[model samples]
Target: MTMTSAMPDGRAERASTKSFYLIAWRWHFYAGLYVAPFLLVLALTGLMMLWTSVLSGRDGEKYYTVTPAQTQVAVSAQADAALAAIPNGKVVQYIAPRTEEGAAIFRVNNGDASSMVAVDPYNGTVLGSWDRRNGLYDLANKIHGTLMIGDLGDRLIEVAAGFGIVLIVTGLYLWWPREGKGFGSVLVPQFAARGRQLWKSLHVTVGFYISLILMIFLVSGLSWAGIWGDKFTQAWSTFPAAKWDNVPLSDATHASMNHGGVKEVPWTLEQTSMPMSGSDAGKMGIAEGQPVNLDGIVAFARSIGFNNRFQLGFPADDSGVWTLSRDTMSNDSANPLSDRTVHIDQYTGKVLADVGFSDYGVPGKAMAVGIAFHEGDMGVWNIVLVTVFCLSIIFMSVSGMVMWWKRRPAGASRLMAPAVPGDMKLWKTGAIIMLAVSLLFPLTGAVLLTVIALDYLIVRRVKPLKRALS
Candidate 1:
């Protein structure tokens, strides 16, 4: 009697395991079907940007390489040269070169148009100029960030990223070893397997190997998404204006400087208010009787330890403060630890507010580090690792599609998604988990709800549609 009861119990356990596996597989299918295309695009564009950055440096850096000289030209003279190069334009910002042998870059604005002029710091000669944000790297950045369709594209990518998290979670569950499967099968691919089994093994092995890094990519990428990143996460993680020592705030935030799909400031300070310049309420900075001009600001920046590769933003208006910013996100510095931003009073030349990585809150700090990793700015090893990771993603995406195609029956009209199980008592738990994900990522949640509604109200009742979609 005991042996007979044991046999029934074992059978019941196997059935339950099979039921849950089927459910997990269905969710994995749903996520992969939606996320694969976006993953491909992201991987390709990311590779393009990374290789370009590593191979050629920033867009116009090649033309700006110069020989180091004993005596450097004045900052004002460099600005004059930049403006002279781009006739009838106002110098909006000055970028100190990464090395003594590199030329200073001046961002000159002519009405609606803007350009970057590379001027030699040694003799203040105009080396070359190019339209700002017109490089291939910048174009690839727009496509990667927002698909180049603006706000709508941003929202869609956010949804895809949300689903990407779902894909990773479900993929892990599906890959988890069952009762008879050994640990070796989980980690290493079984080349001995043939047909669909071989493809499945490759897909599972690669997916499992890259799961953690892929999740990091998704979360960091989502931090820049419009709804989840801008509206929610960024709003919460923004550096506090209260830390600015009661300085008068401007209507514009630090994000205003981030135009044309480029990040010019640190992520932690992007949403924080910019300090106004007119107020005389700050520490002594540029010294008395020294005019707060480009030359004075440059010297002050140097005095404050802002040496190579820092940006000096000109005052936008009478109330605008001169901004000194350096961060890995903007490729200003190689070290993420040294990320800093300082606002100086345009009239008084006093340092109004200064923020660094240490000043950021917990979330702000995490994002700062994460952004550096995401952009491959840490070092040469970082670039190599990220490149390999990107290639892995592309491989996983293609392999997943091939696996699905191989599994589907020939001439099948339906999508052939994993079959829904009968007597599935665990569905309610799955629903709750999905609901939580929906709450966390509202855009993805909306898409899930819409699909459920369509499936229940339309697809389930219509016979032809049911066959086509199931």
Candidate 2:
């Protein structure tokens, strides 16, 4: 008969582990108590980002810009035509889609407000259009972008983001390896620890794996919210807009855009100096002979053969030009403009800003790449990453709430629980972790310091409220 060997007991291992965990548990509880309200807000905001695509089908790229048929027309020409088409209209703003199939919109206001026309740049035909912000898509954009909070909503989002950053900093300290723990204790779950022991590992272990990604996504979300978002994009691009000496601000034919009654002409820098009859560049804008043909301009754009998905803006000035903006995600190097942009002088038939992916330096490249990533526009791979991030947040939130509930004794979870230190080593280890965590999340960190101080002052000196909070 074979003598079966009795496996060694993990008694010493279990004792040390219990000591470490109980210490980790209470301050962790304290940190959570201070941060949970903020975390709940994040959960809701994150959910909005996750579901934006479904917010409304308005972003579905079905919009268009209309003009005289050729291949392209100056967006200015189309705007002028549109203004003529509807009297007493004002140009609100415009957007050129980054795809050949993409539509350009000229937001115009009448007695109330509405889209005066949706133009199909491909054929210069007026496609479907509507007036007013009553569309389901518009509503979705507002809700997703602003949370119906408008400007105040933005500040709140930013504050929550700051809190998130703090949480990440603290969570990292909590995860720092202590003593001689191996990979299993750090990276994977330990099945044997009971009550909150099992859960502390679960919360921490899961966060350990996903923390880097969580920070990226949250920070990126902040960047998407305000004026900084736009500035960030421009800085990260390869092509900086050409700066000109600030002469007396050139008198823009801007009046034509705001009001429809004026005769429309090609917009250019020279035209801004004086009336066309009075100046040379102004003369170049409108012919004594006739306004330049739209078909000719459109054909010029198609001739250059940029990729199909670009938004084309017509000249807003007297240039009779078309501006093509393409969204290009860079493959290597820094230029944000890499693989982005196309401009055609419809008159001189010259390409102005023919930027490729190499144009943006470090920042531009990073920015374009990030926006594409956040929108799930980079490709299938990014979508997978985004999906995983979303699911992780949901899991963390749910499991966290459950774990908090489970660890409490019956009737002890009235949002107040007494700390009974039956174990000193455990409490000591927990304090050390809390001290480390405070280094990152200063707010939560400050609270932890207060508690230890209390344990010194009141809790040790007296001990009633300390029992309540801990």
Per TM-score, the best of the predicted structures is 1
Q: What is the C-alpha lDDT of each candidate?
A: 0.87, 0.50
Residues 1-470 of candidate 1: C-alpha lDDT, one tens digit per residue: 43333567778677767777888788889888989999999999999998888765664665658989899989899999999988889999998988888889999999999999999999999998999888878889999998989999888888888888888878888898877898799799999999989989988998999999898888888888888888888998899899899999988999998887888788878899999988779888988999999999999999989988899899999999899998988877768889999999999989999888899898888878888888898888889889999998999999988988998999988899999876387777776776676658888988888888998899999999998877
Candidate 2 stretches greater than 4 Å from native:
1-58, 62-112, 116-127, 130-146, 177-180, 189-199, 225-305, 314-322, 328-357, 410-470
Query: Which residue pairs collide in model 1, if any?
Result: none
- Backbone clashes in each candidate structure, one number apiece? 0, 45
Per-residue lDDT tens digits for candidate 2, residues 1-470, read 21112323565455556555545544455545544554555555544543543332233334433333446666667666666556788664445445455565566667666564666655455565565455554454355455577776655454445445556655666677766876678688877888777877887788888888777765565454453332332324323334222212234422233222111111111122211111222112222343334444334444555434434445545543444444522111122343444444445444444444455556545655665565455555665677776667766766667777876678772454424444354566555654664444333345456656867878656556655555
Off by over 4 Å in 1: 1-7
Model 1, residue 60: what's the lDDT?
68
